[model samples]
Target: MTRRDDIIAAAIRLAEQSSTGQANLSVRAVAKEAGIGASTLRHYFPTQSDLHEAIARRYMHVAINDFSIDDSARDPAERLFECCAQLLPSHEHRQIQLDTWLSAHVNGLGPERRAPVRRLLEHSHEVTYDHLDRWLQVLVDEGHLDAAEVAPSSTALFTMLDGLALHSIITPERITVDAARDQLRWLIAKVLEPKS
Candidate 1:
């Protein structure tokens, strides 16, 4: 990796490790973790804000890429469930990212400082919406759902997924992946079932 990449990686690691407490990171500390000198880190990052922005951007990208929609699940419902599973992070990692993100927001160093972070948020949302749209199309094509019901169904499904993600993050012990998948399937079945 290039020096810049090394520095960014070190910053992310530092942020992840120090996210829980009052451990204020320093250039020297990050450089030590990164196996580089403090002057080298300074040459690349220049300021604490710059380092923070880099770490935040890297975190956002990692989160976005963690959800892989490329799996060969021909069934739209299965693909949706897979995507949902990706949304549920390990409890420890989720807490770290959540704490770091909240801290960044409080410190006024969130997406506002970096256009890439802002774009990542927008793109991630768009990707989710697009996946839902495709699922709706599949349902309609299979005669399981009415074509006219696409918009409302997609909106409701996305909202449900978002709610489930928040709940899972807050109560990781209670919200297992299987539970989320089962609930999602039940909701979709209810929305798509034909009138008796």
Candidate 2:
């Protein structure tokens, strides 16, 4: 692996280890974890936001690859659903991730610290949007969606998926795993609907 990959791997390990999530992923800590000097890490990731973006992208890549989205034997809609479903955490992992995110980003903070936390949240949203954008682009390329619809479609789809994921985590009794999947499938159908 490249040094850059090594550093990201170290950060992922630390993130997985910490209950506080990526909020506690300080440069000094990541550098030490990677067995590299702070200066070396900076050379690869000049800023905290850059490092966070890379980490988020890596997580999404791994998550997307874990599913059989490439299996052409499955129906296209099913394949699309699987691709989008990758964005949502599985039933067993949802609560843990939600709890970690809350503890890291939202649990306790004054106005003074809100700015940095807000930046983190924005970066997280952008990463999610970016992944959705790519997935939608593929559908567009395959004539399943309009090329012009990507921006709005990605935004709307991400919003729904984000809400569905959070609700499923917070109130599984109301938004059961099957219910969330049904909602996602409905949203995908709407997105794939041809423009009038």
Candidate 3:
């Protein structure tokens, strides 16, 4: 592989394997893993933020592309649950990813590094929100949810997802992935249930 590809692969490996996530990513470390000098790696990514942006873009791309609900499933509620489940940090690896990213955002190397990390964090949340909005809209169209509930429910769902992620990261033993999924489904069911 080329030097650039090698650097990216090394970065990805660190991000995927480490609990601290991309916060643990370092030029010297990645360069060493890629069998290159630090200067050479710097040539490709002059700043830590540049490397972070690349990792964030690639990671988010894969995450979004990987989130798939089997279209063959006839039930819209099931599909919605699947969609939300896909977005949750339900697994150890996923929780690590979210924690690592959030940690970097909060404790970035410096202002220079923090800006790109901020952008990455914001972009990821927006991507998640967009996905939820689409799922909620689908349910609304099917008459399972009210049209007016879309805006409020979207915010609520996103908040719940974020809360779940935080609890998963901070107190994982307290909230298993299955429990989190069940709670998410309950929220959806409660919102969609008809009132007298």
Candidate 4:
């Protein structure tokens, strides 16, 4: 991997660490984790904002584009559900993501702190919608989704999944992981199953 890729990977690793769960980790801590001198890290990142931006972009790319789903899994609902599930972060990742977002709000640093979180969340949202839209269209083409419900159904499903993700993350006690997954699957069934 290129030096830039190495630095970014190290940044992600540091960000995702339980210790660095919050977004305010010092650049020195990240550099230490990356096994590089702080000066070396600064040579590439120049500032914490630059590092945060790079890490956020990498997170979006991995979370949105790198995951694979089975289109020929014989169960369209399951397939589509898997596709949507890829957008949700793991427990550790979720904690880090939530901390990052929450810290941004708490600091009230305006663009300086919130920029990375805003960019990451917004890009992830758009990418999720695009994926959902395409999957809905494919479901219709495959006779799994009814043509009549294409527009409204896709939007509704996208909103549901997005809301569920946030709710599950912010209030895990209220909506347990299994409960969230079950709800998602149930919603998928409603959209994919033919009406009686």
Candidate with best TM-score: 2
* Model 4, C-alpha of 116: deviation from truth (Å): 3.3
Look at candidate 4 and tell me the lDDT of residue 186.
Answer: 88
- Give candidate 3's root-mean-square deviation (CA, Å): 5.2
Question: 54-162 in candidate 4: lDDT tens per residue?
Answer: 8777777666642233365567877777777655545657666545545644444455656566666666567667767777778788777777877777787777766
What is the lDDT for 81 in model 1?
A: 58
By summed lDDT, the worst window of 10 consecutive residues in model 2 runs over 103-112
Candidate 4 residue runs with Cα over 4 Å from true position: 1-3, 13-44, 64-68, 86-113, 137-141, 146-154, 165-174
Model 1 vs truth, CA RMSD:
6.5
C-alpha root-mean-square deviation, candidate 2: 4.5
* Prediction RMSDs, each to the true structure: 6.5, 4.5, 5.2, 4.9
lDDT of 2 by residue, 62-173 (tens): 5444255445466657877887786665677767765655554562243455554566566667767777777777677677888889999888878887687668667879
Q: Which candidate's lDDT is highest?
A: 2
Give the alpha carbon lDDT tens digit for every residue of 1-196 in model 1. Answer: 9898988887777777774665456788888989999888889989876786676556655654323334434555565555545554444476665454444333444444555445545555676666667766666776667888888888887777767666666776776656766777777666666766
Who is ahead in lDDT, 1 or 3? 3
lDDT of 2: 0.76
- lDDT, candidate 2, residue 189? 88
Candidate 4: residue pairs that collide: none
What lDDT score goes with residue 54 in model 2? Answer: 83
When sorted by TM-score, best at the front, the candidate numbers are: 2, 3, 4, 1
What's the candidate order when arranged by decreasing lDDT?
2, 3, 4, 1
Name the runs in model 3 displaced over 4 angstroms.
Answer: 1-48, 65-73, 92-95, 108-113
Q: Write the per-residue lDDT of candidate 3 for residues 1-196, one digit (tens) a residue.
A: 8777778888888777776523468888788877889999999999987887887766775676323333534566677777777767746576566767468657544455666767787778787777777777777766778888888888988888878877877777876788889888998787777866
